[model samples]
Target: MDRNLIVTMNAGSSSLRCAVFERGSDSPDPLLRLSLRGLPEAMIWERKDERSGESLEEELTPPKVDSDAQAVALAEMKDRLLAEVASERIAAFSHRVVHGGRDHTAPVIATEEVMTDLDALSPLAPSHQPHNLAVIRDLSSGFPGIPQVACFDTSFHRDLAQVDRVFALPRDLSEEGIVRYGFHGLSYDHVATALDDLAPELSGGRVVVAHLGHGVSMCALRNGISVATTMGMTALDGLPMGRRPGSLDPGVVLYLIEERGMAPAQVREMLYDRCGLLGLSGISSDMNVLIQSDAPEAREAVEFFVYRCQREIGSLTAALGGIDALVLTGGLGEHVPDIRARICGGLGWLGVEIDHGANDAGETRISAPEARVPVFMIPTDEESVLARDAETVLED
Candidate 1:
């Protein structure tokens, strides 16, 4: 059998998701998917065969060593993929890079110059960019001659309005690239395309997509283009994430440094690693865990999450004049029905009403029949976006 494939990798701070897709005329055909979560301390590796609908999962304990556990996991993943498909038949390796700054508004080949430019933007997205680029570098080294493509999360919001992109700071800082460059563009891009196919009527209308997961963000798509988003110059500026404290006041940051005597690096670490659901609940960062817990702290954390999501939805709705459709994607948004119901419960004034039965059954359209705005649960496919962008770059 002819086997031409593209491998797409999305590496987060603590997890790595890789998939194999066969080259197709319209869209890439998935062959296999692999993910390694709960990294460093312990890794849970899961593999699914797209063709056979079979899955296998196991815990991977790295040998105690000074070397990086993530690198070892990536190398192991590469070996497993190679065992199934030959290196020659793998057309390209695509990646989801978290930031691209101002100039890189489109997918591009990961050349030396491109890598250098992306490296400079790492400080803006310290939690994600470093790991993403590290995976790209590792893949480039492992697959010497194969082309590596970078699909930026910021690229989809490249056309964001000037008002949406500007900060209240000095004009010179904005010119220096300290402006809103929304994250989660890959997921948003997938949802936009899916909407075009599934809800053509709502595709060209105003839409708001809530991408809730380990890293959460919302985007306002005006006729399928990002006009505004919750995230700003960094991913940390958006909705609170699994371990990130999002949208904190600038004054609080100052207070931490001046009053608390915390260094900038310490503050950054706390914001990126110790805050959010984990910090709030004093439990796991996983939303599923928080929901299952009966602790008041956990409940409050969940409530805060939903509250922030509703507020952001309202904010994005205003940005789009009004929301015609609301899309829920990402892990939590797609899986948790109660969370969805809670979020939509407060949006009744904004014409958002969801059918509890439909939502409970995990139906696609969860909105009430008499609702003015439709609510959809669309599972996002960031890998497909990466694959398509890789194909585009290869063609170019």
Candidate 2:
């Protein structure tokens, strides 16, 4: 068996991303990548050979696939991999679990009891937790004896000051695990480690990393550790995202229930799938689409997103006592120049200045020469982090 091979899986609501890495003594080299997205008519499967940088895209016929989405997708992925390489090469399966609750503050082997306890925490991360667990369970059932390590997204923030993790509620409720536990930690951890190589001088200084994607959140890093973050309690509590309404006033929720007579389920649906940029623009949840649109509503949505990001940057800056460097990662953070420029424009007073030419050119360091605080665009490597963690757990 190729014991050095590790498979890392990231299960989303409608898609699954998996990567294969060949681990060596130094670091792992990525082998292949796969993404499966469920569509109305059929499933769209995409695969990339990192070695050759060649990609293949195809649609899976429904008649040949199982009705269960997770089962069919995993089966198809297995078939494709076996066709290219032997199954014995796969050493272990690593999963990106969204919530680790209060106790699972590190990666652990997914035993039956562990899975049951993790499944119980799904209500806290309705959109993500279930899907993540589904993949882990499926792999466990399929591979049987092969170890599956659950690397939690919340584990990175386990060291948050008790004051930061506390809630303004009854002590009983607070002690019942109803406290701030940030998400997107795997992504943030990748960025945190990359900072030293990306900008050595600023790596040890105060840095705020913005992981903006369909699920958006910002983290404040002091000396490469999470001191504060935008996400709290759940993924939905962070900055406004593709569909989630972020940082909503609790009274609005009470009003929806007591005054409007809306059920909790309906309110939950609205908050998780009907709000954010989609609700604001009545357009696409995609930032690219919103940026290209001339509609005033679209402009307003984009403006509001930028405004919120700017506000959070200020808050994180306060948490750090000051700002030294700002690093943007993830889809929207790395690619959308206009959004980054807009977010940084309002922060010029804090010695933040973007080099328009470099920013537009998509350079790694986009800060102006005279700018006191440097800005960087670093792509996150969550799968690599998962693979490394899984390997470590397996070795242990």
Candidate 3:
């Protein structure tokens, strides 16, 4: 059987997730999945074979040399993949690029010109765009002849209303692309599709999806299209994330520069790396870790996260006039029931009633039977979106 496989890569600042899907299937399942976490200092590599139902995990420490640790890991991953499946059977490589700017509103075949355009948008998404493009470059070098597809996380929100996208900045700056461009769109797209399949009735109504992972954002969808989102200009906007501060006043940046004498680079680093849950808790940024800790700071951090999510949900509900359904996705949203409960708990005014038993059991439909607004916990499948987009680019 010569299976044409599509390999999808989603790279983050300190992690990489890769999945292999057989092309041309009505609904394809990942034949093999690989994840690399805790990059640089230490690496944990895990592989799961869906066909054989086997899983393997190991820890690795890359050499202390100056070369990029993630690139080295990708090379090792390519070797393992080639060992199991011939490179000739692979059809294409798809990537989840964070910033598409204005030119890329849809998936495009990776080329020198496309890469150059994408590289210029790096400052817009400093923490993610560089890593995303680096992986694309590595795969382009390693796979040589394979078609590379660039899937944008910003594509889904490209059609947002003018009022929602523009900032209060000067017209020249907005024209230069300082407008709001929401992120985590790949995840939101997957969830929207899942909602249509799971509950077609609600899919066409007003809905709000809370993507609560390491990178957090919320979107308001009416009739399954993005109307408004919490993120603006960059991922640093919207709900607080694992490390990035969610929303901040413009004055704070000026104060850091003028009064505190912090360099622009230092401010950027603090905004992207040292804030949010870590800054709030003065500890680890992982929600799982914070949930386990008994410290007051940890408790406060979790509380602040929940509070922000609840506030955003209310804001999105208002944007939609009223929400008929609510969806929780991403890492923390899917796995952490306590967080979900706490978030929904405050949404009583919005008619979001949680069935405690259902929520605790991790059921997909967690809303109470008589609740006005239905709530669902849908696990996001971004790799599947990447694979679908890659196949489309190949067929074109």
Candidate 4:
């Protein structure tokens, strides 16, 4: 209700996080600082303990998650967020929308038609779009007077070279929204800003940013510009994640549809739900679990994840012309020492040497002292980015 407060929301497929930000005391710059943060229903699907040994699939339970239950879940997620920010008068609400289609490249105030346009992109991000719009719909109606902003994840790739943004298909298909649009952009931008703040020299260098979590991707940045990324077109098209299958053969998808007689819905469900670590391990999707499992599938899952990361790093390095540093961010990137080491192993040709002791201890700098390319563990702060965007966009 006042000039000092705003709400920032990051709505993922299974989880939604929110933060409240308030202006500094009489700061004429119109800048904002974080106030509070919360993650309501993170990993709503039932998950086996990651630390648990492999061959424990029986412990899995339906997390009581319904695929189409976005409306109610969003209402509850927002209610909890509002309760968390109860003391502050929220001036505006901001969200992390995965796809902005083509027009928007910056945070923009959401209008009725804008919501409709974004909704049309559900096919592009079936696992993410509905829940994203659901949060906006419920929250917008709930707080009629508060302004809502859609901060796009795809916006960051708008400046990507045309070669990196388009497909080799016909012009009509390429123009029909079937081009490359990268995701996890909000987190990557935060990585760039964090690096600039704490390690200025490294931020401008050829940097490969690994954003590993339940869902994962890698981006190659030269001076904070995205030259290439692992994910393209859809979030499902990246490195293998918890339940999402990333980068599979197009023929496999067709075989499942045409030969196996799998309906589109069933195929989508398998790709978005049953695949990845879960399908690969025949156990759980949780990284901690796969790391602990003694089963061969579990080992394969971990190996597959790290191996692809290495392969992608090479591709990203080629895009950057060379890598000067590597940043491991997001949930998995911050704490998983072995995973980070495994990924960097194949990159030895690129002159990246890891300090096992530092990495194992979760040190911010994981590279050896003599290593040419610096490796950092910077925890991404998307809420802070959203808060900054909210303040910037809502200012008079």
Candidate 5:
């Protein structure tokens, strides 16, 4: 029996989330071991009230309080975590770093140089990398002696063929660290493993896992191996997300640079921050809000998102010759039944059939039993996987 406590952190552009796990005595399953979770940003947020002329309680409605910066958030979270399980009980902490480049294929205990290297990949994953590294730095400061390991989101796709990873560019450019490194592996890994646990029959077949959250991507797994993925060199490359512009036309990019006089940094902000559902709808980035909104633009944005997901689903299915199971995961995929239903609305030809009652109730299996292809709602557990990885690194 394993005797260790581990922490798994999934830090994003704005929010920092964590889960605590202790290896169970009976269950060999990673999913069952996860116990405690804390989301510092999910609870706290910032917004202004029009009537008060001053900042008021946006946190309370949703009701929360905000810490000043990443460090403060980490310190507070760590303090609370310590109260739950003493620091001495924790064997190690495993963090989810977004882009590992070609060099970092496996998880590594953190070093100053590794932190700097991860920071250098910030441009590749602007929305997630910086914050991921920040959490590492913050933890390093607060828990100086505790060992920490960095597990990357891109490591799963590291084995993609060279032809699939590069653009049609010059040799020098291709060699200069500009290439595809898919993100959200920890989540995809969760889905793949869950597929084995929940339905062993589907584990060795072709499966497309859609990770729909604030940031989104679809991974095509063949025999549980990543043959292709929607996201490329950066998180901004595929699927219109909560607030990110998926793939922009090269012509449009040139127009922004040449005519709009926008610098690369400014363009980056426009794509990474101000685009996607919020930019397209002009209402809110939240999918629930968009669904409820009667505004034409909002409805249009919702339709566009669904349509885009379908398009990619078809593309990925083709790459695998055909699809066996389509798994839905992440925040919206698991909870927002309407979105999932809409995505597979006309996908009957691909053998996807949604069970209306099960979907509405957010059950684990949302697909019709008679549906040609199985559709599953496997809520991702990246944190537990990280914890398991930490345990492996420390004790194995």
Candidate 6:
């Protein structure tokens, strides 16, 4: 238990988010958060104080041109942050891995064999797994003897029913781990636990949480356990994301390959890098930008995003048999009030009503007093969950 600092990392394809937490018995105390983004070209590093909300951002000197350089930059940044800390002992380095396949339903120590197995599952999560592992490998080599843990984003949905996990494929295929393993479990886990303190009534009731950031997904929870979720097999299977197509017909891929003579890699790049808000609007992939533009394409993209979210709410509502509450979290879910309004507009049948003023003010409870289902806006903290898991595994 002498490990002084707990480093929690969530590495994406384009960004690496890290938080340093002071070791504690229950929940670790947040010390500082560092975000390094734009790894491909010019890397931008941002440092924020967890308690005071103070922030500072600067460009990475020499700029990380590729993943290797990015790893080095991260290592250097970590060392700099450690120097600021009074202790040199790092207890553990925890990661937010996107998929755990089937075997890893919980956090596990990331040994060499574990990293190899996770690397094999990279194709299943092209955007996250590789980068996540890269950081792990980097840290492992740089700081020998430090404990590392991998917390799967899919681990939260391990309790989903068999029917919910199946893909209507042959039983043999399902047995081979080709089932609908949901993503964003880490975010959902945070929200689920946070609800007890934030809204006890809705926390114990049937709740559907929508995590709508650059990556979007929804989950249905009964008594704070995952019942069903929108994402399946891969992150690309659910609600449209910042760049992902989301829930496309399988036949579309066949058409692109057979009729249009497209390569699988080409299609993958298009789907993962150039679709959704960007493809639909022919504009930037960021929702903030799309929301501000007055162009018709921008409007169409925003409308389509809202439409898909509305449909997902209905699907998840059916899964829960009814809706007691709806919670929104993530970049767009928390910051953009108009998107939230548009999503709640068509759910009047479910007795969902938004208080315009409350919604705009970013209040916790945005639903009207008389509404049957109360909607809440809560920020998600996946890093905190990962940190606690690291503490548990290390302690155990």
Compared with the true structure, what per-residue lDDT tens digits does model 6 show for residues 143-246?
A: 77888899999999998999999998889999999998999999999999988788887789899999999999999999999999999998998899899989
Cα lDDT tens digits, model 2, 234-345, are 8888689989889999999999999999999999999999999999999988899999999999999999999999999999999999989999988898889998899999
**Error in Å for residue 253 of model 4:** 1.4
Q: In model 2, which runs have C-alpha deviations exceeding 4 angstroms?
A: 25-27, 38-43, 59-71
Which pairs of residues have clashing backbones in candidate 6?
none
Going through the candidates in the order shown, the clash numbers are 0, 0, 1, 3, 3, 0
Q: Give one digit per residue, the lDDT tens place, for model 5 in 132-225.
A: 8888887778778778899988988988888778888788988987888898999998789889989999989999999999899999998898
lDDT of 3 by residue, 275-335 (tens): 9999999998899999999999999999999999999999999989999999999999899
| Root-mean-square deviation of candidate 4 | 6.2
Off by more than 4 A, model 6: 25-29, 38-42, 59-69
| lDDT per residue as tens, model 4, 44-136 | 422122223222112212235444444444555455455446634777888888888887788988899899889988888887887788888
**On lDDT, who's better, 1 or 2?**
1
lDDT of 1: 0.90
TM, every model: 0.96, 0.95, 0.96, 0.88, 0.89, 0.95
- Estimate candidate 6's RMSD in Å: 1.9
Error (Å) of candidate 6 at residue 324 is: 0.6
* Model 4 worst lDDT window (10 residues): 29-38
lDDT of each: 0.90, 0.88, 0.91, 0.79, 0.81, 0.88
* Angstrom error at residue 366, model 1: 0.9
